[model samples]
Target: MPTVAVPQLSVADLDPATNLDAVTERVAALPDRVDVAVFPEYALTGFVADERACDAALERDGPELDRVRSVAAAHDLAVVAGYLERGAGDDRLYNALAYVAPDSDTTVYRKRHLWAGEADVVTAGDERVVVETPAGSTGLVTCYDLNFVGDSAAFAAERVDALFVAGAWPAAHSENWRLLLRARALDGVRWVVGAGRTGARNVPDAPLTEYAGRSAVVRPDGHVAAALSRGERDLVADLDPAVLAEQREFIPVLEATENDGSTRRNSRPGSRNKNGV
Candidate 1:
């Protein structure tokens, strides 16, 4: 069994500098070597109005990401973090996750499933992203993307080794966050790591939202391998490729589904005839 070490970073009051530092400190605290580290949605800046959010929006080739690339290079680990990103036109933005791998250019995945007011704030993504790593191919998704099973299944179809979720999930619906994380992992039969923010935000005039900070890493069998409390900031887990292989071999659900939904089977090997005989 190949064990992949990963961590979930949770924080409040998103600020690029501080959160970046937090990532550094948390990764440093890991006892063994770390393969990857994930951060919450809008970790660089909290969700806010376009004008205010634009102030912190980063360009694909901007210095902010340069700092992230440096972090990956320094630690020799793959880093996935989220931030509001400047789109093609002015006043346009995308809730995006940036994947920075050591000695590699960053790859970005925009949120495809927007929450209630998210579409009004940022444009939805039309595509998904998967990256190859030493541990396995990794797919990226954001908070609301978890609600759409197809989004995760799409990655599963590609047999991605792991899924990374970056979220600013609210405390009011934390159970949904946990259940969805496990479901995504179990249904896809892949490793899943979720990173969520903590703390309360009450911008004047803006509606207040409290974060649950329920970060977790789940195995392919719908079991939580590691998790942090509502306000905790860190979680570590080891994803075993052997376990994933064993589960897939046992059920082979992915292979069975490749035939599409039209395929049917008898309740028992000889219980039914093809012509209903």
Candidate 2:
């Protein structure tokens, strides 16, 4: 069991060159003894209307990623963060989550589902990825993906101990965000860590859309273990795998579902909706 930190900071206009330093500094201040730190989706590149901006995205070995790697190595912690990754052969890009081990190569989890206004520029990933870490087996899913029941079920099938979700979820849909996260935690029967942005983004002629930073960590029992402020902030909490295992054994929800397809085992029934993460 290790503590994981979720950072909910403003992206500061999607400029990675200038923002990476600040982001790194903030991450460095996180609890040094924690096992891992998770950052928001597109934290380096703010949500943009023009998808072409994703083309300018970096590679896993790019400077932006290198900075994150350095932080992980410095702190001796696993690091998970999202960025836009340019495809080598195609013009399209992938919204990717990079899992960097201290002083090691990076593993990537590309977003499998694209959101509205993203089809033109982003390519969808074909499969889910779960990486074995020092702490445990971890799965990565972007914000929109969590809305899909199949995705979480697949992770459950994989027996992932933890799921890391990064996003730019808007304030108008805060309740939806909370519900979706709880649903994922309950359905997957695993720890859920969600890190999202806070503050507003300006659209050309329309009113600004505020990103509600309700970053949180949920237990296997679907209880909120820890949370950050609804505004800009950083928060961390210790996660005890032993406690999670105990709870799973007591409830046996996932096992019951697998054994008999008994709807009686689900905490929430008939709530499956596809809005891919």
Assess the local accuracy of residue 56 in candidate 1 as a C-alpha lDDT between 0 and 100.
67
Regions of model 1 farther than 4 Å from truth: 1-14, 88-91, 259-277
Q: How close is candidate 2 to the true structure, as a TM-score?
A: 0.87
For candidate 1, write residues 1-277 as lDDT tens digits.
3333334444434366776677667666655466777878887666675456666677766777778888778777777888888874466789888777777456778787888877777888776777665557777889988998777767777777788889888899999999999999888888888887777777666788888888888988889988887755456567788888997887576784442111122232112134321
The local distance difference test score of model 2 is 0.74
Looking at candidate 2, what is the lDDT of residue 271? 17
lDDT of 2 by residue, 123-176 (tens): 888767777665467777898998888777767766668888888888889777
TM-score of 1: 0.86
- What stretches of model 2 exceed 4 Å from their correct place? 203-207, 256-277
